[model samples]
Target: MFGLFKRRPKTPGVARLEPLGVDVTVPVNQSVLQAALEAGVDFPHSCKVGTCMACRSRLVEGKVKAIRDFSYVLSAEELKAGYILACQAKLAPGDRIVLEVDIDSQRPHFPQLTCDGRITAQTALTHDIVELRVAVDQPLQYAAGQYATLRPAHIERAREYSFAAAPTPGGDNELRFFIRKTPGGQFTGWLFEQSRVGETLELTGPGGDFWLRAAEAPLVFVAGGSGLAPVLSVLEDAARAGVARDAVFLFGARTQQDLYQVDAIEAIAGRWAAQFRFVPVLSHEPADSDWTGARGLVTDYLAAPHVPDLAASHAYLCGPPPMIDAALAVLAAAGVADGHVHYDKFLDASNLAG
Candidate 1:
């Protein structure tokens, strides 16, 4: 019955290479990046889950299937321009392909890391949010907005989550993460079911380059749902370092109930109130409630007067794809340079590794 959907026989591995200015043979089912890595070719990549378009390369020739649905990552124009993600594309047998290497100095370095940590504390931040604090056997250093993968003991799956804790005064021993419960998510489901204090969970080191850069530039941070985790860490780190750069944080949610860590953020802002602004935007609220804050989509609030002059500011956006896309358009229209806008879209494991 399922034979109708059977895939066609795959072509044999690469037979030759000429357009790429190098000779290399890529195996069937191996991605461009994987093949390049094996051949000692240096390329840029982040997230490796097709979420970050950092590894985007122009396909001068050949056809490839994306490992994941990348419609959300690239626009119609970009797709038309032959921009394919190397991490998500496998080389077609005997297909000649051209790779355009990014020469930008800002490209992130992808490192392989392995570490061990135990869940020291697991507390419910909200009904759907859980805060997990882990203490590793040995300290590990990571940038403020970087992320790590947590693999629960005996579980074959791992989940990616951003940090919510700033570097301790002079050490890297403690790490914190704010995890949101996704319906039917494997790790999230396990996190909600068996996660407890003192249970050891294996972890990988810093895997993201989404940290605070350009300390002197004015900063605008917009976060939705669990996206606040990394933003919180950056803000806290800045505050601890006595950074006086002007910064604003816009946290958006569906309702007051969806907001978390308000008091903590407010406290952090208080430390540098002269240079920090924290605003909570709600999409829906009780009509009878006495709420006077910005009410609309987070992008709408960003378009308001409170949003700073993006020309001289760096913007960090973290949220679902729709929210991030909307915010990117708004920021661009407000004069923010494309290079100054950074974002991370949460990709479901099923949607990525599947």
Candidate 2:
């Protein structure tokens, strides 16, 4: 009776976000990122799984209980500077937390909304990729290059997919995505197993910071597999805005059969305000085949003389971890500054299986 009557420990606290001058309540058992999101705060984030480091914030003042070791993703200097992954840090019970987070002014800030959507169509894009068109219950507003989390009616965990096209000025109730079936991906496996048209899904998003920045630097875009989704969105948006900047798109595929949307890209190039080059690099194309384009890994072309000044370009990359890693190495070797490089790594079930 005494134990039951005793005062319970207070776990809920307030987190003060600097630069933004906002305070959000960190609920008991919720991480700082979770709290911020619940409060409708557009704190930067991607792969809320302690990866990506997009939600990295400096602990200005407070005690935090880390759910996992931050040393794996955060550098020693960053750790020394009190930097922490907000998704992995929970406010200590009854402690006031003060955090410093850099908010980009150019990044679009839209209220994240949740809505139900029905799969209206699914078209095969390649042997392992499909294009899904969903009609959401309410208009979903998102910027080009942003991704959304989707969960089917019965799926336990949601998967992230980038918007395959640019958004309309008002909003678009119809959303599109290009999904590549990962060998053991839960959502993807279920999606490709059968015709899922008319099936309902819950979506939460407009997440990630992969959108195009306002810059005059020449553009270098790299994509592979379904990673082409965001790249296409960004390009479409740029074309619509009449952005007059030289750009080159490097798309990687295993063979001719893997290529899709070549015609659409050509159409975009026609509308582009400046010179635009689309290079599709085939890695496993047959030697005897009629394919005459570049051969070998896509990164090989990063050094080709035909490529523009990579050292003075803004490079946007989206793809599997290996491809992004390879592209990063190539760009670094070509003298592309780290700040000029933007990327979004597509992670599948195998990546988080550990």
What stretches of model 1 exceed 4 Å from their correct place? 1-27, 34-44, 47-51, 57-83, 93-111, 168-171, 348-354
Clash count for each candidate, listed in order shown: 0, 0
lDDT of 2 by residue, 209-311 (tens): 8989999999999999899999999999999999999999999999999999999899999999999999999999999999999999988888556477888
Error of 1 at 169 (Å): 7.8
For model 2, the run of ten residues with the poorest summed lDDT? 345-354
Residues 1-354, model 1: lDDT tens digits: 556778876764441232346655667778777676566554555567676676777776678777886677888998998888878887666676666655456433444356788888999977888899988877676677778889877778777888887766444677899888887776777778865788888988665657776547878899988889988888888888887888888899988888899999998999973578788999988867888887888878774467666667789988777788898888878788876888877665325331
Each prediction's TM-score versus the true structure: 0.78, 0.92
Residue-level lDDT for 307 in candidate 2: 76
Residue pairs clashing in model 2 are: none
